[model samples]
Target: MRNHNTLKWMIGGLVCGLVMMACSLSGLAPADTGDSEVDLQKTQLALQATQLSIQADQLAATQTAMAVPAAPAEPAAPPTSAPAEVPTADETKRVNNVNGVYFEYPAWLASDVAASIYDAPPPNADDPYFLIEVDHRVFEFQNYSLADHFLTPLINVYPLEEYQRVNPGAAAQITLLKDLISWQSLGASRPDGLPFLPIFNAAQSFFTKVEFINTDSVNGLRYLTQFQQATYPIQNGQMIYTFQGITTDGKYYISAVFPESHAILEPYDDFEYTAEFEENFLGYLMEIGEQLRAEPDESFNPGLDALDGVIESLRVE
Candidate 1:
């Protein structure tokens, strides 16, 4: 019985010690678990903050990209304009024939002869008493009353040698006239019995008639009245004509009872004549007159007939 009790006591002591140790180990385990839980929570909070910071940085980069400006493109080029054209001068030119001949009478006639010829009535008379002719035909006769002084005479005579000798320079002019008339009258025959009488016969015929009426010779001035018949050759027959009278001075005066057309005799001063007139008027007259007379038309020659009157009216004043 004693042994059994002792065994029971020992067993009981061992059991009690084991129970205390088990309780202390359980309490320590609970404390350590709590400390580990606190550390894990802190780590989770730090990780969350880092993620938020990264998200904010990404948003800021996206905003910066949106704010920046882009560079501009270049503009297109403009078109060019064309240039203007210029004009040129004319290339063709006209030319005139210098050899052509033209003839006409003076602008004034009836007035000029009256002022120079008639000295009887008052200076202002209705009728001018003057007579003149051209190319062996009578032209005008009037009183010196209402007329301009533009009328003068251009004498055409055959006895130019005597006058030409006195005026030596006139020799060339006389020769030119004779040559012109002769050249124009080439196809026609002369009215005078002589074929070419050296141009003196025409003057002689005019002077002969004047000597018959005004036969009174005093000092160097001889007043004559009658005249002889003039002559010229033609294709069929001779042309006979006459002149009334002409003064010694350059003035050609006539009576009132003269024909409508007559011839005039006048003298000219050599110094006053121009070369243009001598070459153009005188030369052209001689050339054209011969051409007209060679044809010899009595009815259809008003213009040529008028030209005779024009020659009578040509003066150098």
Candidate 2:
């Protein structure tokens, strides 16, 4: 169980403070009363009234903040030491395993959602495999049903080109090829000399992070390759973090995707929602996007930090 933090959300409180200060400065009233002693006394009273009004306004702002409910704290990090705990003979859940690598999932890992298995492989196929969903899924497209159930941050036993060839008839694969072809067509709009880069740009836009980390071989099986990606939703504020690794046999792929609930993504805040602040948040997107483009570095993937011992202890037979 590991979690990669999503892009830090913009702080709306500073905007509120700046706006209130501006309003107070703009609302100064001039009292140019020139008269006798009584007039001076009247002017003093008026000055005191104005000062009290300002104080009341400031106090109201403070009180309003206290009245608003606080958002729950972000989830604590999970333990990712390596080779997550395996079920004892008595603890194994027979219903959840798919492919030869029996999944000994951590508590945080959800049961595999609807999984697809196609047995008929073309002659070049080297081994049997299974694709499973190990986290909550949200489709990128508007349709609630993916038709063939390929919502990603997914675990694919095979990469795209190979997965399609193996499962040619699967709806997900057919849709994937269609989308790939569609993205390819974007090149038509480019000036003749410009390189077509829709795939790269689209990936850059959707991904918040990409990480590589070391993995282990199990029982001389060589499924050591591993990487993780954190994706932010384009149409919504949801966050999806994905971890993908190959099994020791080099034939199976394991992925765990975590799509946070809306409450988790949209935390509670102090400021009253305003159209102006919303516009400012839109501008903040550019700043976050720049953060997203930082150079990739090699490190222990934070996504699996809590599941430290889990994968290496995988028992693939």
lDDT (Cα) of model 1: 0.23
What are the RMSDs of all candidates, in order? 71.3, 24.1
Off by over 4 Å in 2: 1-97, 111-154, 159-161, 164-204, 217-237, 245-249, 253-256, 261-286, 289-304, 307-317
Q: Write the per-residue lDDT of candidate 2 for residues 1-317, one digit (tens) a residue.
A: 11111001111223322322232223222332421111111110111111111112222123343566778998988867876675452342322344443434333233333344433223434321122112221111121111211123233333323443443222232342233233532122211111110011011122334333234532111111111111222222123334444444544333444332222122323335455644454233334433433423212122233233343444443
Residue 129 error, candidate 2, Å: 21
lDDT score for residue 108 of model 2: 29
Segments in model 1 whose C-alpha atoms lie over 4 Å from true places: 1-141, 144-146, 153-158, 185-317
Question: What range of 10 consecutive residues in model 1 has the weakest lDDT sum?
Answer: 40-49
Model 2 has an lDDT value of: 0.28
